[model samples]
Target: MKYFLPATLSAYLARTYLVAFLQLLGVLLSIVYLFDTVEILRRAAKFENVSLLLVLEMGLLKLPEVGQIILPFAILFSALYTFWFLARRHELVILRAAGLSVWQFLAPIIGVAMMIGVFHMTVINPISAMLISRYQAMEANYLEEKESTVAVGEQGLWLRQRTAEGGVILHASKVQMPEWKLSGVTVFYFSKEGDFLRRLDAGTAVIENASWVFNNAIVNSKGRAPERIARESLPTNLTVNEIEESFSTPEQTPFWVLPSYIRTMEATGFDSRKLRIHFQSLLAQPLLFAAMVILAATVSLRMARFQATALMIGSGVVIGFLVFFASSFLKALGASDQIPVLVAAWFPPVIALFLGMSVILTTEDG
Candidate 1:
């Protein structure tokens, strides 16, 4: 006969797991923030005008991005510690002796893990995205001492390139990738002294070897009459890969807007595989968290007296590192189109969950 825990017991288990998770998250975030602050200070050291307050502010702004990276590990360690603590107190043993299966007691922890994953995806991700974007902008403005070469927003795609005589700023309402073409294009030419020299409007622009081939171009020089040309070639240093890389970074866009942004990018004929992979990865967070919970249970359920705690903890750490490495590898493959995006983002968690569950089922009468 199998025993089941009451709702009250399940709730208590969930509360315990939640508390442990929060404590671990706080400690991990603090450590990450400290390291980030030190790194920011080191970078700011190169700029005499930069202040410690500003460095600290940058660290604070970057904390959420760091926290997001560390969250899965936090969940893994929290579950491990919670299980170890319960086992040390003989709580798990008592519950098991009462005829309850291991799976029965694991229910609440898994539920909590899923909930945490959902909360992270829905709430924390957007906030982190905004902060990270701000952090990058500030770092560029202050630390890098240079403006970004490319930008994408609601208005259009904007690019800046330096030429021997002057700099050119280009705007394209639409971009067609692979062939590297732009439509509804406009280009502004400025002299080295920051004086505007001329402007050109073109119906279409195609990237050639070292210049843009504008078609149906109308040139408007500062003091000259407008001249119309069938085609004009202008020098540029920007490359197709560079432009795509700039706008396709997943971190720059919020989770809530990724779908729409992906659609827009696709509409502009840009290959959005990377963004698609990232979106799928976000959707798989809950499953990954659940997998971590199962993996933790498998490693930490042994009584402290029956095995060396250090060995178990070390084993868990190694397993966690392996999982992360495999996930990263698969993501790379997915981004490069070696595998389907959905497979890359989801296979690791699914495999981890099933493998952990299988191990538990075989080792324990769950």
Candidate 2:
């Protein structure tokens, strides 16, 4: 690899690629932040307590998550522009005269993309997860006017649900994993107008299909003395799977945290399909980034005077989006358990890489 491109040349190319990537990222982030701020402002209008500063803060907190979603497109366009600029300045003509092959130059770009993938997994994702978690909390508090339906903390496991008569808040001091049982359970019932209706303290509670069965429960209502019952049932629309999703959503979980969290979900009788797919997808990001570089380079390595830039770029953007949408479709299939996780995660990147390489080989030879 050192022989393929001299150390200085490789450094130069990588530097150029990185500068373009960061510049494009900044541009896109600015545009998204502006739109997000506007949206947050509109949502905060009904709340007298929500200030303009708060709206801006909410948008800034949300921007990283949106950036995570925008990253692949940014890589594609920036790499494409970098290569086109190189060709436009006749820099390639100079390199060609020096006997440098396309691969000699492209290897550096691929390496940069791989590093970016690692950076995203380690640095960007954790930051995004933390900020987005706060963003969700703020959104729920002011805009949505509801807390998360499920949460797990040092205090215990908590859940909430709406009933025809009112709402119920549940707290479990201890959750028996794999057995799907809770001990030291309490349920607070509230009327439709948010008045306290009653409370139930149970020795234990377990889910049986669509309801929670509480054992040795004591009922406390406004007018009546606490009544002990051997068994009690509460009908609910919540399943264990939905509760798991609400507790540890992929967006709110960092990449470093996902594996153990997935295991926890699985241990709690949840299949972990959604989290598994997200994990696999993140694992595949390096290859996907490298593939996008190849695809972008394939469309961009010619001058318009020498080749049709408009047609080639248009075709490239269309193909890039097709690849993106294809990956999304496969992810949806994986979520639905229609396809194997590995296939859904890795296939798009692998095939796109091969296809881009084939086209580059054919064109380079001709």
Best by lDDT: 1
lDDT by residue (5-86, candidate 2, tens digit) is: 8898889989999999999999999999999999999989899989998999999999987898889988898788788778
Candidate 1 ranges with C-alpha deviation above 4 Å:
1-4, 154-156, 160-168, 190-197, 203-216, 229-241, 303-305
lDDT of each: 0.86, 0.85
Model 1, span 266-360: residue lDDT tens: 76667778888888988999999999999988888863537568876887798789889999899999988999999999999999999999989
* Every model's TM-score: 0.90, 0.83
Q: Please give the lDDT score at residue 68 for candidate 1.
A: 80
Name the runs in model 2 displaced over 4 angstroms: 152-157, 160-227, 230-245, 303-307
